[model samples]
Target chain A: MAAIYSLYIINKSGGLIFYKDYGSKGRMDTNDSLRVASLWHSMHAISQQLSPTTGCSGIELLEADTFDLHCFQSLTGTKFFVVCEPGTQHMEALLKIIYELYTDYVLKNPFYEMEMPIRCELFDINLTQAIQKDRVALSGR
Target chain B: MQFFGGSEISPSPPTPTTAGNNAHMMYVFNRNGVCLLYREWNRPLHTLNPQQDHKLMFGLLFSLKSLTAKMDPTSAEKGNLGVPQLPGQGCSFHCFRTNTYKLSFMETPSGIKFILVTNPRTGDLRETLKYIYNLYVEYVAKNPLYTPGTPIRCELFNTALDQYVRSIA
Candidate 1:
């Protein structure tokens, strides 16, 4: 069964707020993942400028030979990056749930600062459970 | 928020009467979730309250869209069920399809939903829905008297919709 490689979230300032590698090997080191997040942030901006339509909604999907990368940017500018197996179903739902969790676990925390790294244990646990449940459901098992 | 013009929404539930089943029942909901225009032709049963039923229908579509997007193996373009009839789209299953009723739904970018319920044998109504949308845009949207996010009460729109629905019915 295809699996999620990693998930990264970058705040509006292009700082990596949340990162996780669901795979055992944890494909890339922390430095590489941070670079990847910042690079994607610039790429997303460049793509928007290159868009012919002024009302373009921005990049939604990135397809590669090995994996499918889905990016969902909320209205508030917090972007959720998900790298998963190709042909994953209900990706939009996943992004939405993640955003909701961020609002609840990260943003709602009084000690949490806006646009900072997500360090909430509740967020971590909920995200893991949500991803596992979604993976299981996707496998139709 | 502006369900019916700028005035405050009535505290009472929108119970605008019941629907008649005459092989054709069409509902036009504004973006504010108000049942602006509900035209029924040959409707027989009044078992369900009209306003309550409209709310329920809207809620059902909401859930159906989420479920369809969740089931879609390739979900792009704002959670559209590009490949429809997935396992989760059905709402009331098992006993839901005892008759020959077909429900076709189309949503415009502006968030207005057009629902047409007809015979199960009815052909694809996507194009027909588009045509109806055009009529709505021209007659209702363009009308200065017709406020946005409010029930559509334009005479021309109602007449045109009635004619179009009759021709297709």
Candidate 2:
């Protein structure tokens, strides 16, 4: 089964708060991650600026045949990213859990530097458990 | 300190009330060496304590959060309390401990009313909210020892709350 390679968090202002890549790391670097986060943030702001005024608040998600990109925003304007393989069901639930974890762990952590790499163990543990639960439900295990 | 459910532990003193009163009060029940507080909402909050006055409501809010674990448990605690539901909907579970005091707020769905859990004597909500939110932002949210989906009580959350409350009052 294809596994999640990493997770990243971007504040609304186009700053990176946390980023991490698992072993099978794609062609990504800290600089690339930061640039991507900034680009995404700018694009999101521009999209909202050009929106129909009432139809969309910001860029919700980007998807293709092979990969899926999910984003979530808090009332205070923080954003979270979840990249997953195509055809993953319950992506919304996964994002919700991740958002909750961020609020309770990363954002709540005293030592966490805003716009830095996400190194919190809780984030990893919860993500793993959440993925496992999904797999179990998916496989009826 | 024991951390449960992504919240910090507060060292603020308890606000005691007689079981006879209908107003909400914070309760802490001791078992073995651990203490558990019972948290709930009696009604909706009518207004946000003006941002300037939130410091006074901290301790009461923490006790409520500690008791309820931040879960809106009005329905779950209903049978236990033998109290009927509020007639419209459920109470929003919001409880947290700050560098100052523990604070809890319950706003009605309509946003017209609010219930502030506070020390029966001081009766402040603004202080509590500000302090608790600050704690979440500063200590609990920043601690590396904290894990998501698990309850919270890192030394940072506790020490910050204690120091804030003591310094203020």
Candidate 3:
């Protein structure tokens, strides 16, 4: 089975900037995705505040019975997260690669606005390619 | 012979205290979002008032449960997002980990929720949470004076809980 089910990217201010589903059985509408993204952002921040020690970076992984959610927050506070089947390996590496793709195709595009919904066609095409590559590598292994 | 005796009797190398102070805090909330118990062992920060803190924690759990249910891949019925779900109705999360801490959650069939915040490096705590539920059942649930849905104030329960948490932490 493909490891990743879906992906979401949230802007620094807790706005859902992008969302894509990679053949997940449970598909969410746009409004639902938006709500989920902002809710996750709040939960992440609250987790940081609820930390007993200093330097906590917020929630990075959530493990459910059937799936796992892995999140990576950039230095600029943008968050990238993937929901995948339970016990999927190499998710952190995949998220980092997605971040790189975002930087290259979306951020570098002169027409792309900062902290806004990602509408870059190049980004969409490259993200698909990257995800497909990962899927193929998994199947080969 | 003397060296061998010393080695054998040296308290087994102090048993390696590598698991130092793993638990940070815990919350026990009954159904209807009432926090029945709150305990802290190593928390160094308190940003919100106790009431507000409990409310936020409960809210987080509520939203997360619904979200997980709505996103269940194996289930055909997709419930409305953000709606409350009955216990055991959804694919509930066991825990979440951040850089600093891990939050392990459990909900009993009776709708009692248990949340344990621990060190991020702590391993899977599913069994530990089950043990904690057992503790609750023994101490508070069976106590004649204890009232359900109220803040837990039983001294025996608190003592037993502290001792158990310390042992595991």
True contacts kept of each: 0.00, 0.00, 0.69
lDDT by residue (A9-89, candidate 3, tens digit) is 999989999999877775588998998899889888887777667677788899998899999888789999999988888
Docking tier of model 3: it is acceptable
Colliding residue pairs in candidate 3: none
Q: What is the lDDT of candidate 3?
A: 0.84
- Model 3: how large is the Cα RMSD against the reference? 8.8
Which parts of model 2 are misplaced by more than 4 Å? A3-5, A22-25, A113-117, A139-141, B1-169
Backbone clash numbers for all candidates listed: 6, 44, 0
Tens-digit per-residue lDDT, B27-138, candidate 2: 2221111222223323222223322122223322223222222112112332211122331332323432222223335432222112233332333355554554566557
lDDT of 3 by residue, B58-169 (tens): 9888887887887776666677877767788878999998877789999999899999988777788889989989999999999999989899998988898888887774
1 or 2, which is superior by DockQ?
1
lDDT of 3 at B44: 68
Q: Rank the candidates by DockQ, best first.
A: 3, 1, 2
Q: What interface RMSD do all candidates show, one decimal each?
A: 19.2, 21.3, 8.3
- For every candidate in turn, the CA RMSD to the true structure comes to 16.4, 21.3, 8.8
